[model samples]
Target: MLARLATLCPAPILQRVDRLIEPLRATCSTKVKAGSVKQEFEKQDELKRSAMRAVAALLPIPEVGKSPIMANFTSQIRSNPELAGLFKRIKKDSASAPSTDSVELS
Candidate 1:
């Protein structure tokens, strides 16, 4: 009955139930020992920590805008007289391209 109850309950509630039943279980020949229960809890904690570390390692680091190298290169281009003028001309040409909003209807 306690085993079934443990399955239905959340971790915190299940832990409390385990604590409540510990003395009764200790007296029962068929029940698990307190040391075994403590070992199981430690194993579960280690598994959770390992899973969290794996997830953190798999995720990419986030930063605002372009990467450092690209950002530095763009800044350099904008600061140079010849490159800055060329970049402005290209930007203006791209901006002047026809937009879907201005499409003619037949």
Candidate 2:
């Protein structure tokens, strides 16, 4: 799971999670009992979830406010009215497209 998450998540997020789990990793050993191993696994899972929630909370939501990249892009688009209009048309078209929730059978 950690390997998969490492591949999927950004480096900064993974680094944060690694820091959060460093203590747990330090205590892990090959001599542990099966029950203790299970307990440790549960603890690690909990820590991972907490780290994810923390990262998620830190991220800027579009509905709340624009992130730096989004803000810059918005500014650029506003500076070019034609580009802004083109984006608006594209957005409208995408919004009006039919939903693909229902799959058509061959």
Candidate 3:
């Protein structure tokens, strides 16, 4: 829904929505930070991987035709060394893992 809205909504309204959701978005980042700390304490690779997925899902997709603001935000995430590394690992792991959604034909 958000992605659809972000894609179709006018720029002025999207800007307003972005402003309204800024605090909530920050909270998601805080949760990711907390998850990182927990992962470090518990030595949990799964936690870190899941947190990376969450961060990627919550952020706007960096595709063409998307809002400039969202594109810039995604660029910032990719530019951060820590986040870029995590995202890289996420991509690698996903590529190696077999698809869970495959269905066998009767």
Candidate 4:
């Protein structure tokens, strides 16, 4: 089962799997003492929960961008100090004095 799971897991995650599971392998091995069995089971349970959460995140949400939702987010973001600074920067750039080159004749 572990071999098959290791095969299916993505490489980046699998790369560190041994480091995580190896130390506990002696206790978790069916042939060995059961001292690390609890740790191994907990690890498997955590992996399952994490996978479920990832799958849930991938599910689509309908009405994800209703106008009221967007308006609320926009208002909240607009209230931010950084947003205010950005707005000031934009306003200052637009309202700067026109240069001689800007008034060039067509």
RMSD of each: 27.1, 18.8, 9.8, 22.7
Candidate 4 — which residues are off by over 4 angstroms?
1-36, 61-106
Taking all chains together, the TM-score of candidate 2 against the true structure is 0.30
Tens digits of lDDT, candidate 4, 1-91: 3323333553543344334333333322223236768777677645533332221221112222233433343344346554334434433
Model 3 residue 13 CA deviation (Å) reads 17
* C-alpha lDDT of all candidate models, in order: 0.35, 0.38, 0.45, 0.35
Tens-digit lDDT track of model 1 for 1-106: 3323333543544234324433322222133446677876666545433332221221112221123432343355446564455444444443554221121111
Give all TM-scores, in the order shown: 0.31, 0.30, 0.40, 0.25
Candidates ranked by lDDT, best first? 3, 2, 1, 4
Question: How would you encode candidate 3's per-residue C-alpha lDDT over 1-106 as one tens digit per residue?
Answer: 3334444553544445445334433532443446466655454444445655543333432332244544554465567675567667665565554332121111
The prediction achieving the highest lDDT against the true structure is: 3
The count of backbone overlaps in candidate 2 is 0
Badly placed stretches (over 4 Å) of model 2 are 1-66, 98-106
Candidate 3, after superposition: displacement of residue 20 in Å?
12
Q: What is the lDDT of residue 30 in candidate 3?
A: 46
Candidate 4's TM-score reads 0.25
